[model samples]
Target: DQQVKQNSPSLSVQEGRISILNCDYTNSMFDYFLWYKKYPAEGPTFLISISSIKDKNEDGRFTVFLNKSAKHLSLHIVPSQPGDSAVYFCAASDSSGNTGKLIFGQGTTLQVKP
Candidate 1:
């Protein structure tokens, strides 16, 4: 019973194309959503995030969209570069505390071809 799920295990795209990654959550109490990118041996680096209060949030080439009612969220990366190839993780956390615990989805491996 994973609360967070990334049904797609992997995604591939051309260097200059858009890469769309999808996620779903079963927990309705979650109000914060985040997307993180991880390289081989390093910890995941935060990319973009969206709160339940907003439908979308964008940062440079990355954007995150959240649909609270459907319990779905997606991250879009425009003009993905070869350097962008990495494993992406979707995470959810309740706003109820500063404990900093997060429920994460199975990561999606993104391959950006040069």
Candidate 2:
């Protein structure tokens, strides 16, 4: 079973528009959540993260909201830019070490039209 799921495999938006990506999880033990953005061949870069104890976290153009009750989380990018066009991955962990061993969803490819 997919512990984490990103229903949409891809999303397309115009530059300067808002881009919202959704994620869902079934495991309650997962206490830490993270979002990573990846390019063609390089490894994913950590964008933002939210702990289960918190409801929301934001960083500049990126905001992540976590709804523990519903086991859902979302990443919102305001004024999405062409440079943001890449694959995004949602990951979860249970207070584990940061060995790059995170349970990741398939990934959502975002295409921004300039």
Candidate 3:
């Protein structure tokens, strides 16, 4: 089973607060992890990523941490803004080859109130 799972369907936070999203995976073969953010009708845009060899990766306002032993990963957004309200999807792929196939979690919708 190569399923990536986002246990929570939504999260709410006040502006300037911290927002955290969680995800889990069943496939140990997945070596690369990515988080994507999506607005209304648009496709998901890549936010951050980390390899299995690394425990964490951070972007400007986003950070992703991976726990290989637990088969879990999480995304953290500091100083969350109203513009961060959107659906976030966690994806995984096997880096062994160039298949370009990504397994995505159901998604977590985050709402930031100003």
Candidate 4:
């Protein structure tokens, strides 16, 4: 069962613009959500994260929002830069299990044009 899903396979945004990436989950057990950014031939790096207790979290130009009721989440990049272009993945973990295992989305390719 694919618990996490990114409906949009890709998103294109102009540089210095705001980019929004969306994700949805079928499992309500997920309590911790994380976003990862990856480039070609490189491992994914953590971007931003949010917990079930909180609706939003922000760091620098990246922000993540969670809607528990909707079982959805989004990543917002303000003033997106060319460097921000990458394959972004949405990950979620069930803290209740404490197994440290995470479920990931198919990933969305974000292209920031200059």
> Could you say which candidate leads in lDDT?
4
Could you give candidate 2's per-residue lDDT for residues 1-114 as a string of tens digits? Answer: 999999999999999999999999999888999999999989999999999989999999999999999999999999899999999999999775556457899999999999
Give one digit per residue, the lDDT tens place, for model 1 in 14-113: 9999999999999998999999999999999988889899999999999999988899999999989999999999999988877678999999999999
Better candidate number, 2 or 3, judged by TM-score = 3
Candidate 3 global CA lDDT score: 0.96
Worst 10 residues of 1 by lDDT: 93-102
TM-score, predicted candidate 1 vs. hidden true structure: 0.96
- Candidate 4: lDDT over CA atoms? 0.97
Tens-digit per-residue lDDT, 9-99, candidate 3: 9999999999999999999999999999999999999899999999999889899999999999999999899999999999999978889
Which candidate would rank higher by lDDT, 3 or 4?
Answer: 4
RMSD for all candidates, in order, please.
0.9, 1.8, 1.0, 0.5
Model 2 scores a C-alpha lDDT of 0.95
Query: Which wins on lDDT, candidate 2 or candidate 3?
Result: 3
Cα-based TM-score, every candidate: 0.96, 0.94, 0.96, 0.98
Error of 3 at 3 (Å): 1.0
lDDT of 4 by residue, 45-114 (tens): 9999999999999999999999999999999999899999999999999999989999999999999999
**Candidate 2 residue spans exceeding 4 A from truth:** 96-101
Off by over 4 Å in 3: none
Task: Candidate 2: give its CA RMSD in angstroms.
Answer: 1.8
